[model samples]
Target chain A: MKTETTIQGLTASLASARSSKKMIGFVPTMGNLHEGHLTLVRAAKKICDVVVVSIFVNPIQFGVGEDFDSYPRTLEQDSRLLAEVGCDIIFAPSVEQMYGTQPRLTNISVGQITDDLCGKSRPGHFDGVAVVVTKLFNIVQPDYAFFGQKDYQQLAVIRQLVQDLNIPLEVIGVPIVRAEDGLALSSRNGYLTPEQRAIAPKIYQLLKQAEQQLRQGEMLEQVLANISTELTQAGFVVDYVEARQTNLQPIAQFDQDLVLFVAAKLGSTRLIDNLQINFKT
Target chain B: MKTETTIQGLTASLASARSSKKMIGFVPTMGNLHEGHLTLVRAAKKICDVVVVSIFVNPIQFGVGEDFDSYPRTLEQDSRLLAEVGCDIIFAPSVEQMYGTQPRLTNISVGQITDDLCGKSRPGHFDGVAVVVTKLFNIVQPDYAFFGQKDYQQLAVIRQLVQDLNIPLEVIGVPIVRAEDGLALSSRNGYLTPEQRAIAPKIYQLLKQAEQQLRQGEMLEQVLANISTELTQAGFVVDYVEARQTNLQPIAQFDQDLVLFVAAKLGSTRLIDNLQINFKT
Candidate 1:
């Protein structure tokens, strides 16, 4: 796979691909790839003639106390994995390369949808995501973009952003890739200690139980409280446990498309995961 | 010329043009076409194979108690003028067609530059302009988009937006078109009575005079004050009269690319104009 560190180089490469009438697919990631990111790449490869993957641990997305400096960077291993998956190009730009030394003046923000779930705990996180993703979309000018459902709120935000901005591209969300123990794959998972790693799967297990309780016609609030209590009892510091519509709007009943979202700290590593539950009734 | 009121129709038409390798030039306007708008259209026609013009009197740009209800719209006449100029398509979408019933959640905002000039009088005006222009840019996907320099702050905002968003299109600013009397051409010019119309020329004349004084080493603040006083004395309610850099940053001296901007009300009708100044020293 070809690796480009500059926007100019990537655009020149993509221009050649476009000239040949190839449909470009983009997958943007914050480095330190795992099975989840590879799944997105594979999905892009399946539908698009050319797949471009961008790996930049965006500084602006991390909050003041968050892991901006400590975020892992493994470009060598990441590129090898991408190449093995038949990726066309990897755009691994430096922070200065992506965002110049000059302060940025333009900001793209989506309201309402960014006020719940992960957005509540992480202020300005979705805005950072929105701006960087917008930059990526423009740089790649892709016909389609692949995103993992693990960042469910982010997926919804991107969808809303594209529609609101009139950006001409399709956003496809691949299903969440989980471990055999039901733990969602994340780059942050690398930070988990052996003991914390053992307890990580419990977070997903509780979400599944919450889904089952909701399916069995339990009260939404009761199910949420129960899960939050269980997660805390299982040695996890729960940030939130809530049920909402797929669009991130609060849903009191499961009559529509529902998503059970959870963000918790197992030791020092913050892990976020969600499950989309469909109710037939 | 083909007219499309729907986004799908325009995209479909542009898609065919793209397949045939035709370059699109776009001119976005707020109906009631004047020589200024036509000049932008003419500029687009010269460089591009397909020229598309969109007339949207964006409501969000107008502040509360602004002239949104009375904003002049001459679609029939605008269409005739566009056709006469050999325009390829006219995209005049309705408010509902563009925004739909749901409120827009996404906003594109540019800082610093938007805090002065028209942005000061009309709060949230540039943000509104930024959002709509961004939407228009995405919808048209033009190779080259044209704007008149009559709205100098707006032109600057668009330039910044394009750079910040990484939008892949060249924004060409055509010089401001003027009436023989030195009054800048504007759709809002129609709101003026014949007397007010005759008085409007003085606004541009004073701006030119200010530019001359600044070039001859007159103090920036004094020149601005004199012009504001002159405009207010001439039966006009002066909104702002100031000199600044081309980027809308405050200028302490006439050492760089300077612009003299004026916004005034002549009997209920507001007019704005700017003149870019170059100092030899």
Candidate 2:
């Protein structure tokens, strides 16, 4: 697989690929790869002639006091995994390469959608995500971009951005790839201690349980409160446990497609996960 | 010339154009075509195989009291002029067609540069411009986009947006097309009474005179004050008369590329003009 570290180099490569009428698929990630990321790459490879994966741990997306410095950087292993998964191009740019020496003056902000969920916990985080993703989208100009549903709010934000900006690309959100115990795989999973790792799956478990309860005609608010209580009892500092429509709009009554989202801190590491509940199904 | 009022029609047309490897040059305007807008079209025609012009009098760019509803849109005349100028496509989408039924949630904002000049008078104007231009840029995917330097701050804003967003297009700023009497051509110039038309040229004249005074070692603040006073005395409500770097950076001392900008109200119709000064030569 070809690896490009500069925007110019990637553009030149993509220009050649485009001229030959290749359908490019892009999967943007922060370097430390897992099954989840590989799944996105695999999905891209299935439908596209060229699958491009970008591994730049976007500094702007991490909030103050977040694990920006300690975020894992296993590039050698990551590239090997990407190659194994048949990713055609790997764009692994340095922070300085992704963002130049000068400060950037342009920002893309998606309102309403970014005011809740992960956005509530991390201020300016989605704005940072919006800008960087926009930059990458413009750089790659991919035909299709793959994103894992593990970051559900981010997926929604990206969808909103593409629609509002009229960016010409399809965004496909792949289902969350999880550990055998139902722990949603995340780069931050690497930060969890062995004991915390054992407990991490409980978050997903409770989310599933909440979905079941809602399906079985339990009250939404009561089920959410019980899950929050259950997480708090299990030593996790729960941020929020709420049910909303697939569009992230608050649901007064569960009559449509709904997703239950969770964010909590087990220790220094914060984790987030969600589950889509389709009533029609 | 072919006219597309729907995004799908334009995208499909552009897609076919792209398959043929035609270079697209785009000129986005508020219609009511004048010599200034036509000059941008002429510039686009010289370098590109396809010249596409979009006439959108974006409501988002106008403030509460601004002339959004009253904005002149001469589609029939505009298309005739575009055809005369050999424009390949005219994209004059309806407001609903461009924005859809829902409210726009995404905003593109350029900082620092947008906080001054016209931005000071028309709040959120550049943000509106940035979003619409970004939408148009993505829609057309033009190889080159043209803008007139008459709206100096806007040219700077567009350049910033392209750079910051990493949009793949060259933004070529054409010099302001002027009337024989030296008044900068503007669609808003249509609002001027015949008497006001005679007085409008003075705004451009004063900018040229200010450029000369600065080149002759006049104090920057004093020169600005003189221009403001002169305009005010000539039955105009002077908005601002200032000299700054060509990039709109405040110049404490005139040692670099400078531009003198003026915005004034002549009996309810506002006029703006600028003149670039080269000191290095």
Candidate 3:
């Protein structure tokens, strides 16, 4: 895949691609690729004439004492994976490249949507995500941008951003890619100990079991309780396993459009997962 | 001009125009086209195959009592001028069309740049400007966007915005277009009473004198005092007239890259004007 480290070069490439009426599908990431990222790439490849994958561990997105320093930088392996997956361009830019000379302090604020769940655990995390995504969106200028549903709230927030700020591109969300035993795939999963890895799938197992129970008319609260019990039993510190409306509002009713979002810790790795349940009432 | 009142139609027309490598020069205005606007259109026509002018009197930018309701809007005259200037497209979307269903509350903060000048007088004015410009930038997705330098701080703010947000469009700041009497042309110039209109030329007259004095190695304090004296003598209320670095930083040096920004009140109407001054030691 052709690579560019400069904004001018990328714009030139995009201009040519745009001239040809080529639909560009962009997948922007922080560059510690796993199955989830590949799934997004594959989805982008299916729809767009050109696929661009940008790998920049944006320093602006990480708060103090956060993973900015050690968020994993496996660009070589990531490039190989993108090549294998048939990406047309890998825009692996350095910090300076993404943020040009005298890059002014810029950020995007996600309001109440960021006040709970992972946001409560990590202040300024959503803002960081919003800021970086906005930067990436401009740099790529894709016709359609792909993101994973694993970041469900992020997907919602981005959708809001596009609508609110009038961002031009379509944000296409790909389904989460999980392991065979139901563990959600994440680069951070690599940081887990062997014993932690062994028990990681239990989070998904609990979510699936809760999904089954809700299908049998179990109360939303009870299902959450069951999932919480399973995660605790599996030695995981549960963050939240709330059932919410598809729009991220916590709800009492487990309607057809309910989304079960979960975030928990197994060792130092913070893993998040979600399932959209569309069962008939 | 192919006029579109909906976002989708505008996008379709714009996309078609751009896909063929047509150089699109965009002029985003709040309607009520004056001589200043016509000058920008003329410039756009010279450089682009497609000239799309958007008339959005953005409500977001108008704080309470900020002339949003009284903002001059002459669509028929504006349309006539645009057609005369050979504009390819006119996107004059309605408020409902511009703001979709359930618009999210997202504020595009304008940071330190907004804290001085008009921003100080009108709190959140730059934020509104930032949000609306972002929206227009997304909708037009132009190769180049044009702005008149009469709004000196605005040009600087937009330049910084494109840099900070990494917006993928060339921001072209056109020189301030003015009336025959040296009054910088503005739609709001229409709001001035016949007497207010006659004396409105004082803003430009003061800046020109200040520019001449600065070029002759006059101290900045004396120059500002001269400007303030001349403006107050001309039956205009002086808001501020100060020299600053092109980026809006307060400068003590006359021999530097500088801008002389002036804001004044003619009767009850407010007017602003600016000029670039390169100082040599």
Best lDDT goes to which candidate?
A: 2
Determine the backbone clash count of candidate 2.
0
lDDT of 3 by residue, A11-55 (tens): 777877877779999998888999899989999989999999998
- Tens digits of per-residue lDDT for model 3, B1-281: 88988889998888767667788889999999988888888888888889999998988788887788989888898999999989889999988887777856566776787788898888888887887888888888887889999987888888888888888788988888888899888888888888888888877777888888877778888988888888889887888877788888888554787888888887668899888887553
Model 1 ranges off by over 4 Å: A252-254, B252-254
TM-score rank order: 2, 1, 3
- Report the alpha-carbon TM-score of model 3 versus the true structure: 0.93
* Candidate 1 C-alpha lDDT tens digits along B1-281: 99999999899879889877799999999989998999998899899999999989999899999999999888999999999998999998999888878778999899989887888888899999999998999899999999999998899999999988888899999999999989999988888899888889998899888878876888888998999999888999999887787777787653888888999999888899999887754
Tens digit of lDDT per residue, candidate 2, span B1-281?
A: 89999999998888877988899999999999998889999999999999999988898999998999998878999989999999999999998988889878999899999887789999999999999999999999999999999999999999988988889999999999899989999888889999888888888788778878877898888888988998988889998787788888888564788888899999878899999888888
Q: Using DockQ as the measure, what is the rank order of every candidate, best first?
A: 2, 1, 3
Backbone clash pairs for candidate 2 read none
Q: What is the TM-score of each candidate against the true structure?
A: 0.97, 0.98, 0.93
CAPRI-style class, candidate 2? high
Q: Which fraction of the native contacts appears in each prediction?
A: 0.88, 0.85, 0.53
B19 in model 2: Cα distance from truth in Å? 1.4
Clashes of each: 0, 0, 0
Query: What DockQ would candidate 3 receive versus the native complex?
Result: 0.57
**C-alpha lDDT values of all predictions:** 0.90, 0.91, 0.84
In the predicted model 1, the residue pairs found to clash are: none
